[model samples]
Target: MKNKLAAGLLGIFLGDFGAHKFYLGKPKTGLLYLAFCWTAIPAILGFIEGVSYLLSSEENFQAKHGRKY
Candidate 1:
């Protein structure tokens, strides 16, 4: 199971490299984010996603990611 705190922090800090995506077992999506990382879009989006993750209800997070925080 994924740790929401870890994932959220990774998304906020290392998300430009798609660290959170990798942690979530999404290698393909992680690669896509890495490919576009130089554009800075991935970082911005990652930050938003990180915030979303931090704010999400645990049940909702589990339902979406199929794992517990």
Candidate 2:
């Protein structure tokens, strides 16, 4: 299972390149974030998402972003 704390940190620090999304197994979304990173939107979105991930329950994070078995 993916860890929320790790994902949150990655999102906060490296999410300009969609690091957290990749960690969460959402490559398509990750790629999109990376593709548009030049606009600064990804950075802002990443910080928000990082905070959201940190605030979310483990069950909610897993249900939304965990890898499929």
Candidate 3:
């Protein structure tokens, strides 16, 4: 889950390429975010998603994305 954590943290800090999405096994989303990263929307949204993930409960995460480990 390190990747996911990194992605969420980095994504919020540096989500130009949807790093969080990539970490979550959503390469397509990551690419999409990367495409629009220059606009800075992805970065903002990434940060939000990152924080959400960081604050989310383990059970919620597992229920939503399953055991990525």
Candidate 4:
């Protein structure tokens, strides 16, 4: 299962490289983030998403991301 805390931390730290997206099993999205990282938009979005993930409950996260791939 994907860990919300881990995802959140990654987003806040390595999100510029799309680390959080990769961790969430979204390779395509991760690559997109990488592509636009130079623009700094990904970093901002990642931070927001990270906070959203941290604030979300397990059930909500699971419901949105699924239980198992």
Candidate 5:
């Protein structure tokens, strides 16, 4: 299972390169983010996603991601 803390950290720090997406088993989206890493959009989105992950309930995260972190 993926770890929420790890994923959140990755997203917050290396999310421009889609590290968190890869960790979450979303290679396609990860590649997309990587391809667009030159833009600031990925970083902004990643930060939001990271914070959302950290704030979300565990059950909600599990239900959405299909596994516990």
Candidate 6:
């Protein structure tokens, strides 16, 4: 998806279930996040991660998301 902002927002909002992590191809981390999601740590961290994603440059985001130039 081109809209990293939208995905990041969704990650912040629904990252408790590791939805964002899944979308980003981090299934292992996503599962862990999902497992401990009830603690709210994943949610908070996911929100911060989302904001960081938004703040990062496009090339950086593409790399994180596994996109090619």
Task: Give the alpha-carbon lDDT of every model.
Answer: 0.87, 0.92, 0.76, 0.90, 0.88, 0.80
Better of 3 and 4 by lDDT: 4
TM-scores of the candidates in the order shown: 0.90, 0.89, 0.80, 0.91, 0.91, 0.82
lDDT of 5 at 33: 95
What lDDT tens digits, residue by residue, belong to model 6 across residues 1-69?
A: 446876688687887778778888779989999899889899988888888878888877877685546
Question: lDDT at 43 for candidate 3?
Answer: 76
Ranked by TM-score, the better of candidates 1 and 6 is 1
Error of 2 at 47 (Å): 0.4
Residue pairs that clash (backbone atoms under 3 angstroms), model 5: none
Best by lDDT: 2
lDDT of 2 by residue, 6-48 (tens): 9999999988899999988889999999999898899999999
1-69 in candidate 5: lDDT tens per residue?
567888888999999999989989899999999999999999998888998888888878777775645
Clashing residue pairs in all predictions, respectively, total 0, 0, 1, 0, 0, 0
List, residue by residue over 1-69, the lDDT tens digit for candidate 1: 677888899899989989889988899999999999999999998899888988998878778775545
Candidate 1 lDDT trough over 10 residues, lowest sum:
60-69
lDDT of 1 at 11: 94
For model 5, the stretches where C-alpha displacement exceeds 4 angstroms are none
Ranking of candidates on TM-score, top first: 4, 5, 1, 2, 6, 3
Question: RMSD, each candidate, Å?
Answer: 2.4, 1.2, 2.4, 1.3, 2.3, 2.0
Question: What TM-score does candidate 4 reach?
Answer: 0.91
lDDT of 6: 0.80
Model 1 misses residue 44 by how many Å? 0.3
